[model samples]
Target: MTHRTLFLTGAAIALVATAGLGFGLGRLTDKTPAAAEGHAEEADHEENFIALSVADAAKAGVLTTTVGRGGGSELVLPGRVALAVNALAALGAPVSGAVERVHVAVGDHVSAGAAIASLRGAEGANARASVDVAAAGARAAAAAAARDRRLFEAGVVARQDWEASQAAADKAQAELRAARAQVTAQGTPSAGGLATLRAPIAGIITRVDVRVGAFLTQGGLVAEIADQSAVEYVFDAPPASVGAIKVGDEVLVQRPDGGEDSARIVAVAPSAVDAGAAVVRAKPTAPAPRIGSIVSARVILAKGAGGLTVPADAVQTLEGRAVVFVVEPKGFRATPVITGRAAEGAVEILKGLNGGETIAGKGAFRLKAELGKGEAGHED
Candidate 1:
């Protein structure tokens, strides 16, 4: 073959190959639409399939709500029950004496002016003897004064003599009065030579420091009596809670026996202990368990006027801020929230959420993971 004919054949073969490739590409482009339609149908069927993966379903978890209440905050403090000073009585001996006999034992309830013990001592005995002697002297002075007065009135005695007699009688009467008071103070008259230690107040004898035959001083304590009808609970609270706790605020006393009692804040200490802790006192209406008994108290700092609140765990940290996930039709969304004081395992959401929004109550962390997965799948 000639060189020109060879070149032309080669060129023709190249052109045929190019044409065949273009035809094959065009056919491929035409079939692609049908293939794409099949894919679209499969996707439509998948969209109807509501089956969520185990992980995705787990991410949904349970739902819960939060509410806002009118309470400031609650401060729980450990405390102990004590006798109100006004209700406590300390029985003391008016004179030095040996306790001849104890009429009351510990835990014995008594009334005001009730005899708790009898004291036999030299001072009490001397006071009784002086009272007897003064009584006789007073009688003699009275008779003499009366005779003098009659004589002066009858003009048988001088005015000066009658006046002097009157003065002497007045002195004698004063002496007798002093002696009687001393005898009475020792709790003895002629009733017996011994002085009886009377209860200073109406209450139960919580403590007995004296027994029969125990010698006690004039100012020595005989017994401690406390009214068992009412008690006081004293607790120390943080200084931050000072303003929150008010006089007459409700208090709850937790007994060690698994029972609860109610009380009201009677006094809030003006000063703070440990710089940041204030002493709060409450009066319990229930029977006084015992003096110096340990108890727990819950002081209500605020009350419920009721708005919205959510579980504390439901709020999570996102981008260095507090947030909660609200399930939206599109997916789970992170909602920023303004949180308030948390109490009772829940937190107050001051803002960012309205009531009736479904929140992931159980597994919020799992929801975050599923959301990340959905985003990744979209990118793919």
Candidate 2:
């Protein structure tokens, strides 16, 4: 046979084989082209599934939450994490004294009652002396009261005299307690009578003005500390929205890093402030983000309002499609979803999910990354 003829015959055979293979696949699937395409897509979806145990998912911080009913409307407001008023400490000089030693500096973290500075002066000496004096007075008064009580019982003293002595003893004892409380609250004066200024709360010191040997008057600012963990979200809402916003309403706070946290409204200003703008406050369910980090707060005006919602972070992009990891008995499956309006750190699931399905929420990004790694490994 000629080479050209041989080539043509081989080409025809290749075409026939291709057609037979296609027909065989169709018969095996018992599906039309569209149906087969769909089946292949489903297989691809299955491949993206992550076979992570619930324990492993928890370890990875892939926290799962039930898809919940969303409110009819959401109130989105600009807000920020702020230090609680009580969490801030402006450490001041407890007495008019010169700083003898500085124990901490700006940016230092100190536990509650940790010393910040030492001041030695007559004030501390006087406080120590007052405690000693109160103790001595208490001892003397108690001895006198005991003598009077015995004399009265022996008919050697009047009842009024015994009562007076008892009163004196009680007053002296109260003074002693006050002195001791003062000593403890202001820190025990050292052997040399140095008063140690200490942190009132656990926090990071933001400022320090005292230096060794510097004289500071009582109540003078020595340093400032802020408990970063003691933070709440504050939002300024329009006056029109203030009426609908209420304490104890659910709040969804979105951090700059894309993490979402749930909170409850803690305070709503009785009236508008700052050019008629109303203020709202929320207590976060978890430790808040850094103070001053700009965040958006979605306040659920009416809880149990109506539609299915999941955390915004629950939705992720996989292969250019919006997907969420729906939990399964054995593992998780990435489900394609159609999303609607988002409010309160939650996005509405318009389709592709039934209410009550558990899905990866706050740390859903971890699962997305995990699924990507799985796809990469399969390709290799």
Evaluated with TM-score, which candidate comes out highest? 2
Q: In the order shown, what is each candidate's alpha-carbon RMSD?
A: 14.5, 20.6
What are the lDDT figures for the candidates, one per model? Answer: 0.74, 0.84
User: Which window of ten consecutive residues has the lowest lDDT sum in model 1?
Assistant: 45-54
Badly placed stretches (over 4 Å) of model 1 are 1-69, 72-74, 156-167, 189-192, 211-214, 255-260, 271-276, 288-294, 301-341, 344-380
- For model 2, what is the error of residue 121's alpha carbon versus the real structure, in angstroms, after optimal superposition? 1.7
Candidate whose lDDT is highest: 2
Question: What is the C-alpha lDDT profile of model 2 across 1-380, one tens digit per residue?
Answer: 69999999999999999999999997887878898789767556347688787789999888888988866547678988898768888988877788889999889999998989998877777778889999999999999999999999999999999999999999999999998887765567854578888888998989999888788887889999998888999898866567667789898899899989999998998543447568898988987878889999877764455667889999999887789899988789999976656767889765678787989888889888887887886686
Model 1's alpha-carbon lDDT is 0.74
Stretches > 4 Å off in candidate 2: 1-71, 181-186, 190-192, 270-276, 303-380
Tens digits of per-residue lDDT, candidate 1, 255-370, equal 88878899899888755445756889998777645667888877665466653577777787765667787665644566777665677878766567776676655566665565
Models 1 onward score TM values of 0.55, 0.59
Screening candidate 2 with a backbone cut-off below 3 angstroms (N, C-alpha, C), the clashing residue pairs are: none
Pick out the ten consecutive residues of candidate 2 with the lowest summed lDDT. Answer: 270-279
